[model samples]
Structures are given as structure tokens and as C-alpha cells.
Target: LIYIYDLPADYNARLLQYKHHALACTWRGFDAGNHTYLKDSVYAVETFFHEALAVSSHRTFDPEEADFFFAPTYLTCYMWPVHGWADGPWYHAPIPNPRPMHAANFIDEVGRWVNATMPYWSRRGGRDHIFLWPHDEGACYMPSWIYNNAIFLTHWGRLDADHVSGSGWPPDNYSQPVVYPRFQPLDWRRMYKGHLCYTPGKDALIPAFKASNSYHRSPLVGVPPVKKDVLLYFRGDIGMYREWWYSRGIRQSLYRLAMEDKWREKYN
Candidate 1:
């Protein structure tokens, strides 16, 4: 049902070379290892999703016989910050992460390449095409004029994520504007085309990566609805990216207030 395009390595396969660069850049993401079957890391979705489609029964080798065409590209791996376990992430707290610009340029280069070299993209203006854009802000990072016309499988589904005021600047999640050569847009109000992360009916949401063996540890991983036992089920870290002023400053205050003897049972 799907035809996978043979894109150059730079945009797709070459990005996988990062897996050896850092622990966080592993094939399982967050360095979870390769033997795990039940992977839970949401960041590895791009690899697993693409791998599934590549070997799935639904994939068609001949473009003419395909219902959908998939052009593989890994946007997050390019923007993923290079960090070590010692001093920490490459970017200092005061200095904002600057990888988004690089990622945007790579995207722009891909757009131009497809427009110039690929013949299939012009077919019905790519209505039957599909892309895997697993960025923090998701589809907002892709150009609407090219890939946007097709289906986008992304993690973030916000249509209005601007990474406002450089807030989500961990090098991976912020918004960066790109200036195109010879390409003009009618609307400039938004940095990227369509001015949104997701369009209601057109785009679809894909889950983050989960290695197959990862499910072995969790016995509660099933369809049956278990009893709701506790509240506040958060998985990610909740703290400041900077010491000066973390946006979630109110959380610390709320935690302290809740711990008080007078307010244990209520007001979360």
C-alpha cells in the first residue's frame, strides 16, 4: 500500500550514523540498546515506524502499484543536541540552542532537491505522498508547498507552536526561520507554511518509539482497562532548563504547599 522513495542518504539513512556518536543517539534512542523488544521511548518512533513500513506487507516496490508514497527523512536526529555525561549538554543555559537553523537549512535543501530531481512529486502535486516528521513541533518544521500537501505522521500536533520567545530552545524543540532562494510566499505571517503543527483532518499522529522487547517488563500492557489507582502520571522530567527563571516556577511553590501538614489530601 505504500511506496518508499529512494532518497539520498543525507536526508534519511545518513542521519542514522549519529547512533554511534552519543548514548542518546542510539537506535533505541536514549541509548536503550538494540536487543530490547518492548521499547517505550517515544523519540525512537521515526526509526521503528520507518523500519516497519520498509518490511511490511503493505509496502509496494513499484510506485505505480502503490496507494501511498513515503519519502523518508529524519528531522530530529539532525537537530538533536550533542551532549556528554560530564559537563552536560553542549549548550550552556545562557546560550540558546542553535541546531534548529541547521535542521531548517537541511529541510530547505531537501525541498529544492525534490522539486528539481524527482518526477513523482509533481504527480497530482503529491496528494498521495507521506512523510515521517518526528520533531518536537512536528509538521510545522516541514514546508507546506512541498511535503505539506501530503500526509504527515508526526508526534507533536500543535498548529500554533512558534517556540515563542526562544522558550523551547533545547536545540531540538525550538522554531527557526529559513530564507528560501527564488521561492516566494504569499503569506509571511507564519515562519513556515500552513502556520500550524497539524491540520485537523489532513495529518495524523504517530506514537514515539518503543522497542519490541520493552513490553516484557510491564504486565499491565494490555487492552483491558485496569482500575485507576493514582493521579499525576507524568513520565518526563519536570524542572528548570535554566536557573535564572524556569517557566514552570509555579510548580515548586505548588509542591511545597502540597507537602504542608495542612494540605496533604487536597489541592494538587
Candidate 2:
């Protein structure tokens, strides 16, 4: 039987305590066992809110039957169709996309909560797959990893907006399933220099998804002080290429392109 615990009022602090205890027990077990197989084979899993997947490359949740308990208040299930592309033409212009079906906001919140709470769980498994799907009564509804993959393939497509205002490009943005890991090297700080207003990487970076201008502190947790910059690139013309560049302001370009049949064909 599985025993799950919903988080308490002071959830974050309590989660930390749980992590400490779990680690202590694991370490003691390691010492007593005198073998690393138990540690090597064991993997902790957690599910994250889908929205949080847009910003970071961590999936921190597992819905196993035994020995898995998580607080559900900070987390919620996320569900959406995995077909059609939400990029460029889709995000730029408001079209009646029938497949997106149910648009909801709980995915991101849930993903962030899990990743933040169980910081180490995502790295535990041999190859972790953070399943994303809707749920009821704090239990995941996904049947198999194969189902998760199929649903993802059906929905995979380009995003209309290159970047989100606060988060980077999402995991499913490219319309494929490939995990790219970013390790912390000494040059990590240098790599993220211009990331204040724009993502500095080749794929995920977008200048527009930057935080609002009023934000004075760095978005990352333990990073050095850097000059604050606005994330949205508001100055651009009304065209597909320019829209892709402007991030949020692409809405204007999307309208212009959609109204003109000639440009619309270019997208099709």
C-alpha cells in the first residue's frame, strides 16, 4: 500500500527536514550494507508542474506505490493535448486551435513545488522521466511511460512565442524528446552573463522572456550581482522573423501576419 502525505502549513521547511532524515537513513544503510548496489539501483522520482519545465531542466516527482509521500498543496496536476504547435504563427496570432483542449496553469506550479521540495530526487533514478499529466486526489493518471511518450509525440510542435517572459523555452518546445543536461562548470557564471534580459544559450535563450524591468535582483538563487535589464524586446516590425525576435511583443506581428494572406501562406 502507498502512503502519501499532503504538505502542512510550513511545507518548505518541513520538506527540508524530510530530505535530511531520508539522506541520513540512506547513508546509514550504505554503511551497514557495505555495498553500493542499493544506492546505485535506487532512484527517487517526483512530478513537477509543467510550467516550471519551461524555465529549468529538472523533473522532480515520482508516483510509486510504496514509500513515496508528498505534500499536494503546493502542487497540482497539469493536462493538455500533445498535438499542434503553439509556436510562431500559433502563439503570435489568436487562432482557434481545437487540439489544445483544456488550457490550465497548475502544471508549472506543481513542477516547481516538487523540484524545490525534493531537490535530489530527480537525479536518483538511472534515467528519470518526470511524467506530466492531469490527476485527481493527488494521484497521477498516466498509465505507462509509453503512454506518456505517445501523448508527447502527438502534441509536440513549435511554440509561437520564442520565450516566456520569466522562463526560458519549454522542454516540449522543439517537438521532440531529448534530454540535454547542463552541468555546473566554473564558466557557468560567464555563460549566463547576458541571461538577465535574454537567455544566453543557443536554443532556450530569448531576450524577450526576461523579467520585468522593475526586478532588481537576479532570478537565479546563489548568483553574483549583475546589472538588471528588461526582458521584453518591444521594438520590432510586424513580420514573422521580427515577431520571433520580440518574444511577447510577437502578438502584434502575429496579428499583422495573420491578416495578410501572403504572409500567412509563408507560415503554412
Best by lDDT: 1
**All predictions: root-mean-square deviation over Cα?**
6.8, 21.3
Taking the tens digit of each residue's C-alpha lDDT, what string does model 1 give over 124-193? 6877878777765566655557545777787666655343322344544444333334442322224354
Best by TM-score: 1
lDDT of 2: 0.27
| Candidate 2, number of clashes | 25
- What is the lDDT for 244 in model 2? 46
**Candidate 2: worst 10 consecutive residues by lDDT?**
39-48
Angstrom error of the Cα, residue 25, model 1: value is 4.0
lDDT of 1 at 185: 30
lDDT of 1 at 241: 41
Give candidate 1's error at residue 142 in angstroms: 2.1
Cα error, candidate 1, residue 226 (Å):
2.6
Report the number of backbone clashes for model 1.
16
Show where candidate 2 strays beyond 4 Å: 1-66, 69-105, 123-268
